[model samples]
Target: MAEAIFWVSFAFVFYTFAGYPLLLMVWRRLARKPVKRGFWQPSVSIVIAAHNEAMHIETKIRNCLELDYPCHKLEIILSLDGSTDGTEEIARQFESAMVRVIPSLVHEGKAAALNRGVAAANNKVVVFCDARQRIHPHALRQLITNFSDSTVGAVSGELILVETESSDDDTSAPMGLYWRYEKWMRGMESDIHSTAGATGALYAIRRELFRPLPEDTILDDVLVPMRIVMERKRVIFDPRALAYDKVACCAEIEFRRKVRTLSGNYQLLVQAPELLLPWRNPIFVQFVSHKLARLLTPYFLGALFVSNCFLLRGFYLIPFALQFAWYALALAGWLAPERQQGQLASRTAMVGKSREFS
Candidate 1:
């Protein structure tokens, strides 16, 4: 029983990070469902949800206005969800026919802000973005091209995380390396069917397909895209549609993000139980492998470590020592958090240098 438990836990840990992606690679080769992408110039509405984003609002609005898309075909909406700061003031300065502002008197969270902004969108495609990222000039052009495929209902843009001048030169830090790996996996999943979710920093959905989110909701990025997937429409990733964001100014920021994501996963299970039912969700296999498995991986790692202690003989000893070393290194980093930022993780192949906040 000890050996059986040990191997079961070990297999899951391995499968979560390595086996699943390897499976995706082989599966796509066997049965690839490619998106029939072509040039498309649909009138687009860019929606930004914000609260106390004064530092980034002005630049974000300008970035939206300066996109390579036709000015006559585009409109920008800023959903100001009760900003007590000068965020509303700065955003209002740019209000015009091309730029619209919707202000609320109380803070309603990002999901509610997006609900309001998207509600006011009049264009065929609504491109959602955050305040901090600087989208590429042609990102809108690249995103819309995927909609030429009749089956595609949404398109997610790639997020590239560049280092600040003050940061270390090594891009192989834990956050940087892990993020690029995740995106690479998402791209593979997209080719097979639809991505598990869209990137909140930049992604476009057909306005008509839009569903208003709960005001207190979390993980709008994941919830919105998966809901679209439930409608049996394809949600694909476009690498050329780039949104560049600076790495988090602090290491603790990443930990908070992880907590939010994990919490949001639980919220999703309660809000959309159909996701777990294979008959209801068309992408159930992908959802289980990509999202649900990820949520349970850390516990699997814990189980692997705990179960290995009972079989500490011969070959089992090797894995036990490796696990010990990994945990010790993790503990050391936690004790001395300063080491988290500049430290180098093992070098590996990277897609684009990218990371995400939502």
Candidate 2:
């Protein structure tokens, strides 16, 4: 019984951290192909849902205005959801004939706010971006370029964590480290098949493919792209198009964000059961590696510890020793929280941060 449990635990970790990445590399190599270019420019509506984002609204609007796409071909839609502050007023200042502001009397969550923006959008493609994030000058052009392929239903841009100009030595330590690893993983996933989820910070989809999400939906980003996948269209990730955003001010704030995300992940599993079944999805490799492995991480970790505890007898000591080493590392992370800024420390911090945010 102990041996069985040990093997099972080992397999879970091995598959998640090692096996999955190797599979992605092989798949990506086999799937590599050159992209065809054309003059398939489609009208795009860029939507931003602002909830008390007064400080960033002006800059975000300016960024949208500066996009490389044709002015007549692009429409900017900013939605202020229940802003008691100057969020609406700030947004209004940026509103020109090209930029429109949709104000909600009461604050609805992000999903509802985005839905309102979608209704007001007058374009063939709708691009969703966070009010707090800044897009590269060519982001919209790069994203829209993918639509040249009719099979591409959605396109997600790379999320780049911008380091604050003022850093007290460890300033880029947290956000920089986290995003680097995330970018690496995303690149691997993009090479293999469709990415599991789109970065909510910057993603675009065909306006015809827009679906209204539940009002309380926590992960609008995941749901939007998953909906496109459900329609049998590929959701491609374009690294060339990037969105930059600041990291949370503190670990606690970051934790709350992660908790909400993790809860949404759970909700996704309940909402999309077919994604869990390998036989039903041809891109089973993506579903299992990107989503399932993440959802099962906590449970897998616990099972490993418990199984190791029971394997104290002969030869079981090896796995038990390894388990202890992992725990020691976790403990060290807790003790010297500042160490969490480095690459290894940041990855550990991210796991803890996710749990706290959830």
Question: 1-358 in candidate 1: lDDT tens per residue?
Answer: 8778778877887888889999999988998888888888989999999987887999999999899999999999999988876899999899999999999998889999999999899999999999989999999999999999989989999999888864444322767988889899999989988998888899999998889998778888989999999999989999999999877544555555789888998899988999999998988988998899988888878788888898889998999999999999878867764645333221110111222111
Global lDDT of each candidate: 0.86, 0.80
Model 2 ranges with Cα > 4 A deviation: 33-37, 165-178, 279-282, 313-315, 337-358
Write out the backbone clash pairs for model 1: 161-354
Count clashes in each candidate, considering only residues at least 3 apart in sequence or on different chains: 1, 6
> TM-scores of the models, in the given order?
0.92, 0.87
Winning candidate number (TM-score): 1
* TM-score of candidate 1 on Cα atoms, chains taken together: 0.92
**Tens digit of lDDT per residue, candidate 2, span 43-94?**
8899999887767889999989999999988899998788766888888887
